[model samples]
Target chain A: MKHRVAIISVGNTEYTSLRRETRSKAELAFAAIKEALDEVRISIEDIDACVFTSVDGFEGNVRPARVLESFGQAHNVPLIDVNTGGSAGGSGVKEAVHLISAGIYELVLVYGSPTFNEVVDNQQVLNTASPPIFEKPFGLGAAHMGSLYGARYMREYNLTARELAQVAAKNHKAAVSNPFAHIRAGYTTEEVLNSPMVAWPLHLYEICPVSSGAVAMLFASEEKAKELCDTPVWVEAMSSIADTFLSGYKVYKDFENLKILAQRIYKEVGIKKPREELDVVEIFNPFAPFELLAYEALGFCEEGQGVNLMKEGATEIDGDIPCNPSGGVLCTNSGISASVTRHAEVALQLMGKAEGRQVKSPERGLAHSWGGNDGQFHTVAILSR
Target chain B: MASTEFMNKEYNMHLDFSVSLGPAYTKWMKALGEKKILANKCSKCGRHFVPAKPFCEICFEPIDEWIETDGEGIVESFTIGYAKFRNLPDPPYVIGVIRVGPSAVSMVHWIAGFPYDKPEDIPDKIQIGMKVKPVWAEERKGDLLDIRYFEPA
Candidate 1:
């Protein structure tokens, strides 16, 4: 017997690489935490415990999770931190789900603060995941490694740069209406194709930028959800499965872990075909080629045919199955919390609070994220209203 | 509320140490320094693993045996970059994954001597299954840079 849980509120600060120098990191976090608590008409005192999701060394703090006391009113609370690489936000939400599912806490605050500064080199920060001896000597950094995957995927599936640009152009166009998006500009296919090549088959526009932001979500049990909000966005399922540590050790050309995770969640939620059953999808795609890999992995389309969805405009805002109506990670990714925002985006859509980028009354939605090296870690959650 | 809008302090924490190469990588690193490419053989599955792992992910067997290669491989995938990155060779270079010898697994490395005039023409120059050979550096340091890059055999 699974205990049902619902997200009462979801909020996040402005997503941007250039944050105000005057503001402190904790102040930025409080803005998001306060916004989420206010949506549910609950004070910080009402929340039982907190699950803080963040990276270990990135925040310039010894233990990044212990800084939750700075979240305005989160003090003396049973706080647990979860760091599953970039999927920390989704993992934190999952921990809260377990707490409610285990008949423990009724109200849990899920918070994440992913920060980076002007001094940090974005490529070097991510390249830390590479194995020191073999990979480092070759200069196979994060961006270079992603391009490697894109190159293989292109050669194996006969994918072209033009097709990949269409994915980027679509997301960038959608971000134009999203106030939270970091990079919001409608790029044409030719523009993206002609853009400087970061790696072969991938251009500068295809990669995600290093933005800074914080996110907070209020999770409550079914009884608590009924008392607080009229329309509760239920958490259907969350699946986190990781692969081998090295991308060099990956067996599959595409996202095999995501496929395995999607199958498990789909079986649990009784989803026959994800494309038809789900009304909306929010995928955490750091690169353009990843979006296509996700489409095939999540059963949105068959392998090598995700390009057809782009060509036919089937994933548009009003298409059969809308994908990333709030833009996506391609436009605004603040590192750690990027994956967590995937869930918040879906929850907002289901709660009819998606503001400008809301889809046409989507009842069911899916959120996905990939973290760590070589697309090794994948977390998926199915949400419904 | 306690606030700090005026104070801006910066600090750099620099720590350096050596990590044990363990049973597998220790052997592989030493072999690379000696101008040899090595792959760990999974005792149970009998498969070769490049960039050696302690055990097989699929079979869960400790890598007991090793295999040596003549530094020949085929291009599994290739990507050419035009921008210059820190501590790397000049611009307009090819980097790719190559399946060394008869191993099922591939290693990521630099692919030099790729037939490409402009960055735009790189997509058509290198294809999967292209033969390549390693080009070692003059001063070998028993690291990844021992073999400078892999070129058309």
Candidate 2:
């Protein structure tokens, strides 16, 4: 039998417009953690350990884990600082699940804060991710790297810029009901098209603004979850894969990694035909193109047919398989928090806690993460009621 | 941060240093002094690699053969960055993925034709298959910086 784990409670800080708030990183994280504890009616003494995730380079401070001792972690309990660039949030969730699966802790709290958005020239930091001696000289920032894949995809596959805009417009509309979302304002296709180009074929509005926020979730073993909360989001399957350092993997061409992960996740959860079975999905699309790519990659739709899924309204909030009901990274791209928040969104729907942005009967929700230059690292988790 | 207390000091020590080059990079530096771009060739696999590698990841064998690559290439893809990372040249520089010979692999380097003095004047009219050649430094001294960038032939 598989070791069972579940999310008992979820909490988050109101995603603050960067210009509206001026709080330190620790203060922001503390507020989210306190809210999560209060939601579950638990105290700091009851928490077993903490998994803190954030990209330190964005904070201009390396080793943020050491500085987190002030955030109410008990002296003896473990605190693991996790960082995996944009995927750090999902990585924290995977770490929490592993902690319970290994019988190391009965309950663990995972939290990721927003530190990437407040900094100036944020793209410069992303460009430095490659080896300084070799790759950095070429100015390989996220957008530049994304364009390489985007241009190739557009050229070879005949994907248009309008389809990319549709994703941004769709997510923006979804955020209208999410009071906690950073950007809830609706956008028109013309508005996205009229915006300045951050990178060619991608406009300013088409990309997410780095925002200030924090997300926290409580993870418990099956027994503790059953005894504590009325509704617990069970973790049916979770897996993570790292690609080659250079973007020379065969999976990119065949789009095989996501297929393999999705197949295994479905098998583990005893589901057939994900598009027909899974109730909701929150796939990371840091760039607008990746969501459509993921729709195909995750086998939600056939290859070269993701655009049709969007046009057919299958990915709408009330559609067959709602995609990104919480506005996703498009509305709020707070680096580390973006990926982590996807899990929290799924957990909320599973527990019937998502207030305005909740989906109906979301029995099985999929949260996925992609990071590294040219979408190198990936993680997928299947959460069910 | 250390210099904040002393307002009168003319100079302040900044400990912003990095160990950039690894072991295999020394050979590439030597080759650069002769105005040549060199990569290690896998004798067993017939593959050439830049910044020189000791072994081929695919063949799992030590690469004993070395090949001198032609400095002539074309700009396969390029980006004009507005901000600089740590220890790099000031912003608004033209960098490109240079495609050389039969190998599809492209090396990232600065583009010489770009006017670093007045970056705004530098045209964005560069094409994908434009012919270019490496611009070597006047005084070659066994370093990767020997070729500052590549420019149109």
Candidate 3:
């Protein structure tokens, strides 16, 4: 017998524009956790376990589990801090669901926060992801690696610079209504085309902005969920996959990791033809092009027809499949916190709590995260009402 | 095999010997010394390359043949750096992605002959379609540094 788990409530600290805010990353996490419990009509004592996620290097610190010990002290709960570059949030959710189903914990609190706005050299933090022995010695950073992929993608796909511009334009338009988005205004295709290119085939506007924020989710066993909340978003299925860190596998053409994971989740949830089954999608596309490419990679569309899906307004909020209605990474990037943010938004949508960004009658949603150099690691979750 | 090992000849130091940069990249620096940029001509795919590497990303086969690029290209994109890194030029220098020919990918190199005296003197330029050519150093070495920068064509 498997124990069913549901997200009862979601909360987050308001995104800070000014870099000089007094709150630390721990404070942000604590505040968001507090708010989440308050909304769910539960206390810290109710949480049977807690999972915190953060990229310690980005905070210019390490062993954040000790700092998060305070959350455990209040409730006397077992706590674990998961750090997996940019996908820890999704990993934490996966772990929380398993813990609940395995009869270990009844309620789990998942929280993630990053103080990117206060970092001295964000590039130095990002550079550490490269292997120290071989690649890091050459000073190959994430931006350079991403550029390499973008250039290769352009050549292989014969995608024009203007088509890439469309991604930026669409994401920016979606950000207009998101109050927490780092960039709020929509940009015209001409504006995006004219913007300075940060890396070849990737313009400044197409890239995600560094943001400081935290997000928290409250998960409860199905029995506790019914007693605590009126609307509980069900976790239909969740899975994570990882590839060699420095192996430089053929991720572009051989995206079987993501495809296989999607197929598995779809099988678990009894869905076919994901484009029609999934009403809302929140993919961790830090780069705009990946979102379009993922449409094909995930079997949402036929090969080489991803651009057509976007041009037809199929991915818009009111279209066939709404994507990134929360403005996504293109609007606000808090590093490892992105995974949790993706899950939280899906939970909100399923609970009919998403304001200004909700997709109507979203019975099923897909939330995905991909990180690690060369797009090697991934986590996928299927959420439903 | 034992008899052959016992009859070993005298070992002598060789002044000129090929160095393996990594896997494939055998003849590129030699071409650079002659002010030439070479890439492998995949007999299978017909794709040209530069800073030549070992195998084709597409066909995944050894690329033994080499072809010289026409050495004419345009700036696809560029960035004006405000910070320094290893082997990169100083602050306010332009690094651009230049399209060499039919290849989809562009080579990144620095821009030369730009007025860098004052912030205002910085060209209100750097368009995507700007034509540019590689500028080799006066004394060439068969290395990536052979082309000091890409100057306006």
Candidate 4:
């Protein structure tokens, strides 16, 4: 029998561009970690273990998490650093679940702090993740990969920049009410398309900004969760899949791993008609076109109709199934931390704590994230109240 | 960070890091230095791979055969880069997703040194499935850049 896991509480730092956040990386992470413990009225000594998630490359400090031993309260304890590109946060929580489920630890805290500063050239940071032999030599940034996918999807699905723009505009508009969102200008289609073009088929507004932030989530066994919190969101099911590290090796470009992941997660969670069954969704879409791709891949709609869902406003805050109720990654992207925020967002919604963007008494929710080379890695978790 | 809150430090590393090219890449890059194409083939599934990986992703089995190939491929898709990711110096350039030989996938690389006979014909010439060959750089250092770019075959 699988051990039941519950999310007791979550804490996050304000999502803003890296340049705007000058505090030390530890300070930023400590702020969120401290808040999570306070939410559960617990002290650092209470946690049994820690799962640290973040990219050391971004911090310019190698193995910074090790340096954060005492600050993370995992000193002298096994602090497994779950590093999976942009989805580290989600991966960490999954690790926490396994730790508790395997009877290794009763309580675990998943802490992630990914920081980018002006010191490193913002443009070069993302490409460093690419395998040097294949992708890095081309010097293509993350957005270019998005462009390749967006361009092909556009050609195959008859997608338009306007359709992609709608996603950006919608997410930004929604972020207007989200205090944590980094870019919340509420741009229109024209304004987004008019925004400086990054790569052909991708404009500035269509891509995510470099937001600096941290996220901390506390997880415990079902028994401990019930005692600690009135409403502990249960982890129903979780799955992660990876495509080839080299984008060139992956033949299909339909976000194939994500689609495979969705089928498995839906089956495991006993979800049918995900659009109707899941109360709310928190998906990662660093690029706007991906939102539509994810919608189709996740079975929110048919293979090519994700754009139609957007055009019809089927994913709006008040839609039948709201998506990215906390403005999604497009609005408050902190790269690595953004992924876990999805799970946290859904947990908040299920616990009736999502103050600004709560769905109507949501009972079940799905949180999703993808990262690495060419959407190479994906994590999906189903949560229930 | 506030405008007032900051520290600037310039640090240079005297040491260089190295990665094992593995058996597959060690042979592949060695061949690149020789202006030859070496690819890995899965003995189990008969699938071929360029920029050879250690194993067949499909079969998850170790590749046992290595094959030499004609340095030719076709453009599967193309995009023009007009901006940078962070601060990486990416100027305007055309990137083509090239499907080399009958290999299972395409490699993301530059489509430069275009052998276009006319300037106005560039777009019409660089269409999908257009046959192209490697434009070997004069000097070879057993690296990917050894073959500067792909050009019309």
Candidate 5:
């Protein structure tokens, strides 16, 4: 890295269901950008560059960055669009880090657009993400893509439905305190089990809602970060992994790609024991069972032992190595924004600015984002105060 | 606190795309019309692809060799759709990750041909690693759907 980069500020809007959203695309972008800039006490002119992350088809507009003027376009700032399916947010943030760390830009802004806002029927739109000829006609949607992992994982480990619900219940319980979270109903294990089954081995509550919201983050060089804020979360290490596009190419038994990614990142950061070394963590889990799958993939526990972590209340707010203190994407998924929130939430926790969902004085945290076709891409970052 | 009335606009995207099957997939799909399942084997890796890849992703070599299988696949994993959604089949459709004919990878398709007293019993009728055979469509069009679905064999 040419220069050290740190996260200075994060801006988030109140999340709601897609139909209930009142803010237009511009409004959503403006509100989040304004809040991020206001927190750092800097205007859009101060930022050197901007990065926008969202899927083209999901937004209905192929080039959403061109349509949305709130990303420093008025000030003539260069904007870079990043689209890696759901992992676009993480990739955008990584681009910002590169801009600063390369000594090319001092301040960079990454915006996580509400990707699902323009969809009439989310399932119809999501079905388009499948391979057009081969997989699309089979009626495989996002939930079905997520259910493949759960169905295979459960059979592999003899994991029961009640155990999966318990893992989901943890996130639902944590979301009650997160003001930015969309589904704050705080469903319990019984409630999750009782919810209507959308896909076998996955209840309706276990899946993420099609949320409407936006999030933005400010990344600055070490010198700029020192001048801008009292507390800044330093980017220790960041990297992402890619897999084959066809979902069938992957073995659904576990997050093998994520496991390989975590190993590479952990080795780079010299993290011997991820569960003991990291104080707080965030995982991209649109499906409830994914959190448990992620737990094993992230090396929080040994293989087939993620269930024990859930049973022991290990990932709760007060538990050792608390995960998804902001309720996670399992509760509120605004597509790309949800992936960006994983990093933003960790930064907030490290800065002691997490408000209702703060983990106690955390020094080191990990943020992960999973997206693309059946987990084609995964981004992992290690952040510290 | 503001009024709940939010003005909304709607736009529909009606777009069609024509994808080229290329040489590898062309041969594979053409075989399906004759009720034959062909898998392309990578020389370097010796791993077969069910859908017949143009090149092996791992070896990065062109898959020139082809082998025909009996279309018998093992259910690697599966999910039963229990709820209705737009552009998808009705409830109780089983989608399985079927590893056909010694292929290193699995392909997703519908799993059918089992007796179920009720729609809810669909999940119980299927199991991972269960052997299945292809059920060809009455009219073949050299498409992936040429095989209607896989059924318990």
Candidate 6:
């Protein structure tokens, strides 16, 4: 809180399925970094520090940050590597904010690498994330981890399959305008219901695809931000929460940890009404049901009333509190990159540069990211123009 | 220029590990072989942990007391796998979050031994908060798999 930090620019590479991706890891990093630097009209030498975010073994290389040339070696900038599973992207941004806010660095670059680019079977790798001795042998994967929440929430709230599909259908429709999205089928509610069920209460359309892409964001101190860019999205407040490593320890009825975290952060920033005060929002929804759960946890509506908000079209791009205008992680989940894009998308929306997915003259917004085994960690950031 | 062909390289890692199950997990796993479920109770907070925690997270105290449960649990939540993935079990398998006996925290295991006409009928057959009992394996190995799965009681 000593020094102020702001996001000046964001860079993104085109997204595609992991099987069809032609861009090499290094190439993807280069293109995204170049675009970000070019947008700010600066070179790598101008950056004070860089933060690389990705999971360790998912990249096939344990130290993926070292393998890629983030121009840190040539430019003599400190490149700090951060890994917190899927929330690594959000945690990396938090690190950059700390570096600038603590008066250590003026300008920092956070690169969200494609964490699942090298995987042959993503579920095999994701299975390793579970508690090896106890939970790993029960055939539990990422989708199954997500479905535990969907099944319990549906039961407690009497949420029908059609209601859950409508939420997924909303995000799919939003992805139609996102050029960077991997799956832009723009499926309807009926189509979502028709999609193959990967896990109970979660269909193929509700789950995120194994997308391949990269994203970069430029963070600067108050002075550097004012000097380099005209419209800088200011960081209002940001923090993350953690849970037990064992999935069994958590109660799957709701986002209990996220609700506690939102209360603390919202209280810190004096956000009385999250649904009214925030102009736009971006949520970490690798599973479509998460968005609805997050809506309740974020206090956008009363618990179990998320479906009502969706039914009324209140979260649409043109409606009040437009969420996931970038189509969210459901459409393009390049692992950590998708988490970082949640923040990057909110920044762009507040800066009036969201292109086709821009909300109407947004001044303040919120970005959230969830990761680790069965939502072990969650990061929430409040941003404003 | 964008190339039409992209070369891909394949690699594999076959690694094995032997993790030390400390005093708490050792006792819990050893009990499984005898068809018993042991839960360690935290003296400070009075919260019991199934798979027995060495210490209470909230109370921050080492747990030395333990209790033996009847091996019956209530399903808190469950998911039915309808699609097959590599290295995972076949479709129609159910994974349940069951709070065994008096444990404050639940443990995850497979839920089976219910009658169903088709694979798709599995989801409808199970319900949350349903009572389930352990189905012991023929050969006990002091492992989590000692109880093959949980069946409706």
Q: How well does each candidate superpose onto the true structure, as a TM-score?
A: 0.93, 0.86, 0.74, 0.91, 0.99, 0.99
Over the stretch A1-385, how does candidate 4's per-residue lDDT look in tens digits?
A: 1899999999887877765666667677788888999998988888898888876676666577877644444446667888888877778888998888887788899886654542355557677777776778686777777777776777677777788788889888888877777887887888998998777678888888878887888999988998899989999988799877876765434778888899998888778789999889999988888888889889999888988898787898888889887878887777677888888889988998887777889998989988777777899998999
Candidate 2 vs candidate 5: the lDDT winner is: 5
| Superposed model 3: Cα runs more than 4 Å off | A17-22, A68-70, A115-117, A251-256, B1-153
DockQ winner between candidates 3 and 6: 6
Q: Candidate 4, clashing residue pairs?
A: A20-B1, A21-B1, A22-B1, A122-B86, A123-B85, A123-B86, A123-B87, A124-B87
For each candidate, what is chain B's TM-score?
0.80, 0.70, 0.73, 0.79, 0.96, 0.97
- The alpha-carbon RMSD values of the candidates against the true structure, listed in the order shown, are 2.6, 5.3, 13.0, 3.1, 1.0, 0.9
Mark the regions of model 6 whose C-alpha exceeds 4 Å error after superposition. none
Clashes per prediction?
A: 0, 0, 1, 8, 0, 0
Least accurate stretch of 10 residues (summed lDDT) in model 2 chain A? A246-255
- Predicted complex 3: DockQ: 0.03
For candidate 2, lDDT tens digit of each residue in B105-139?
56667776643445544534554568888888899
TM-score, prediction 4: 0.91
Q: Pick the candidate with the highest DockQ.
A: 6
TM-score of chain A of each: 0.95, 0.95, 0.95, 0.96, 0.99, 0.99
Q: After superposition, how far is residue B36 of candidate 5 from its true place, in Å?
A: 0.6
**What is the C-alpha lDDT profile of model 1 across A87-158, one tens digit per residue?**
777888889998987789999988876645433565655556666665655555566766776877877788
For residues B50-111, could you state the per-residue lDDT of candidate 1 as single tens digits? 76678887897777888898879888776676666655546677777788876777877888
Q: lDDT of candidate 5 vs native?
A: 0.92
Clashing pairs in 3: B39-B49
- Evaluated at residue A207, the lDDT of candidate 4 is 85
**Model 1 stretches astray by more than 4 angstroms:** A19-22, A71-74, A117-119, B1-9, B84-90, B113-124
Angstrom error of the Cα, residue B54, model 3: value is 19
Cα lDDT of model 3 by residue, A1-385, tens digit: 2888898999877665435345655667778888899997778887898888776655655666676543656657888778676788888888889999787888998886663544544555566666553234334444555554454455566678899789778888988877656678788788888876555556777777777778889888998899998989989889888765542223343355788788887888888889888999988877777777677767788766777889999998898888888888877787666779899888888888887787888988898887776566788999888
Please report the interface RMSD of model 5 to 1 decimal: 0.9
Q: Clashing residue pairs, candidate 1?
A: none
A299-373 per-residue lDDT for model 6 (tens digits): 999999999988888899998989898889999999899989999999999999988898999999999989998
Question: Which should have the higher DockQ, number 1 or number 3?
Answer: 1
- Measure candidate 4: CA RMSD: 3.1
- Scanning candidate 3 chain A in windows of ten residues, the lowest lDDT window is A246-255
